[model samples]
Target: MEFFGMNKRKIIAIADPYSTGHHLSYNKLLVEAARRNDFKVVYISDRIGCKYINEIFPDTDIFINEIGISNSKISREVKKIVFYIRAFQYCRRRDIACLHIAYIDRSIFSIALANSAIKIDKLLITLHWNYFSSPENNSLINRLETKIFSWLSRGSVNTNVHSGLIVDDLYIHNIKSKYTPYPIAVLPSITSHEENKLSCDGEIDALVTLIRKADVSLLCFGGMRYDKGADLAVHLLESLPEYTHLFIVGKPEYFSKEYLNNLAMSLGVESRMHVYDQYIADDDIQSIFNACSIVCLPYRESFSGQSGPLTIAASLGKPILASNNRFIAFEINNQSIGEVFDSLSFHEVNRAFIKALEKSYSPKEFIEKHDPERFIESIGEMYKVNND
Candidate 1:
């Protein structure tokens, strides 16, 4: 249904505070798009200051504090104590309509606390996994937490009418979502920039220099976490000795530079591969996006349904060679957007990489397909009609 004869409502986003990074930069695109469509966007996070709080949310606000405290406390429980208290206080002060959770724990505690304190409507949550069953949240205490959380979610949904998950891939194991492993709807991240942007002199020099001096031709963007498939990509690239460069942007969750270097050296591609594990700020992003021709994410599972890099590539109109199993494959099912490779075999990936290298995409077509205009319109519809 098209929206007509109406005013855009205020839309607030409650994000999870996981240390800091532009990793959540996708949300910025959503906020911009929403505002352009006439909805007020209010973003909240405790990592940013009171200035940010004031800037993001002048009236009804939402925030959480999960950083600053060392994990070296008497118990892991101590850290959570602070997070819940801060989140609850923020909700109470703002008269929040909904709590948009970034993770399961954040949902469980914040919803539990919010429900305890006041009448919060539209309590929606996002899940980070497909119901396809992996080594995801099945710990004993986590199970108990999930059961309680699901109970709260059902209650909230009944009351509020507004809720979402980035992707809805529950029922993979026949387990209900009242707990940690349940599927949430998809709410993807985005990446955007000005139009008609061509490669700058310095960016051209950097890519040319890499091509001339080093053998790097590929880029794996994002944290080198275990599930993120960094080592797997490394292994696959090791087999493709002809493909000289696999430039990894971002730091590793566990392995250090020395360890990754050793892996490259052992694979005999150390001379060709490069690792820029330093922090890449928001201002440097446009150049970074322009530097690479393709963005590769070969994960064993989907990001529940969020893909910051994938969405960025789609927006920037760069080809993406990703794993077929992820939820994004359903949306980005074409060569220009990039194709999926086998997560199991190096041979499968080698062929996929060859095809991906042969292909490129048009920015115009990508923006038309995945532009935030339609989504913001849809979200605006939901915002106005969800509670009514």
Candidate 2:
């Protein structure tokens, strides 16, 4: 591809469907790395994602496209098939050297079906979850997808996973894979005045104020889903001291605000629980984390994968109270960052919660291990090696 008067042959195309949550920061990191390595990027995402990228890096030679996929499950699947077909066509037309799929779960079937029809120099997939880690995922459909994905991995496609445990699992299956530390966005430290100024019209400020009122607050950030053990977080509040509060942030996916509040009220811990059932912007993240004493990740046993919040908490030097997921438990124990609990057992969670509050943590080692520059360099090297 030619930009201005210069021809840049190393072109990487990154495609992610959703723009919210970690995608915004993760995509921005990839774009930054691509720019630093002199590789032109074609970022494909939903309309909001395209706008977000254009606004952040206005001067960079990056091409952004809107992948028109609706929110409905069936509609999204059909649209994804069409989108991948068109995306590959665009890649070929532009002579894009590499196509990296940021999330591979939803598009596995589409890509497998389109594998023979489309051609690209290099294809990379980031596996966010280790589907093969659990026997519960032995459903027929999952098995079929696993077979297809394994076939794809055995070919020209290279898989990128955040967990070393996942890499070992893939190795046993004879799939080519590499481990890259999950990129954590470096959020600027905001003082009380700056935080109040950056709040979403006083909403976040009010939440922060309420959380700070507690002597020690536990924050459960991100989507409130069943697998994430949102209910367990509320339950744990019953066992802790009254002054030890719990803050639930992020949009509620499986449980509503009223449901959680009613649950808390029924358990007699309503006074100590704060729930912000809305999406929190990136600028406001550090302020919320700062307001709380610890970050809680009560994910269930089925979720044997890495967590964005875990890394976020580590970066800010906040102690964590997380479930014993394979990757999360390993990170906490290996880095000496925080405590792990049995998510299914209330007694264990409460015990671990108290211990985590009392324990002094030093996240200097964790921060150094997951430095953003190291992640960026690894990703850049992956693309450079593939291109060569």
- Over the full model, what C-alpha lDDT does candidate 1 score relative to the true structure? 0.53
241-343: candidate 2 lDDT, tens digit per residue: 7778899999989988999999999999998888899988778787888789989987876675678788778877788998787677888898888899865
For candidate 1, which ten residues in a row score worst on lDDT? 158-167
Model 2, C-alpha of 168: deviation from truth (Å): 2.1
| Per-prediction TM-score to the true structure, in the order listed | 0.72, 0.90
lDDT of each: 0.53, 0.76
- What tens-digit string does per-residue lDDT give for candidate 1 at 336-358? 57877756476877777777767
Clashes of each: 16, 0
* Cα distance off (Å), candidate 1, residue 276: 1.1
What's the lDDT for candidate 2?
0.76
Sum up the clashes in candidate 1.
16
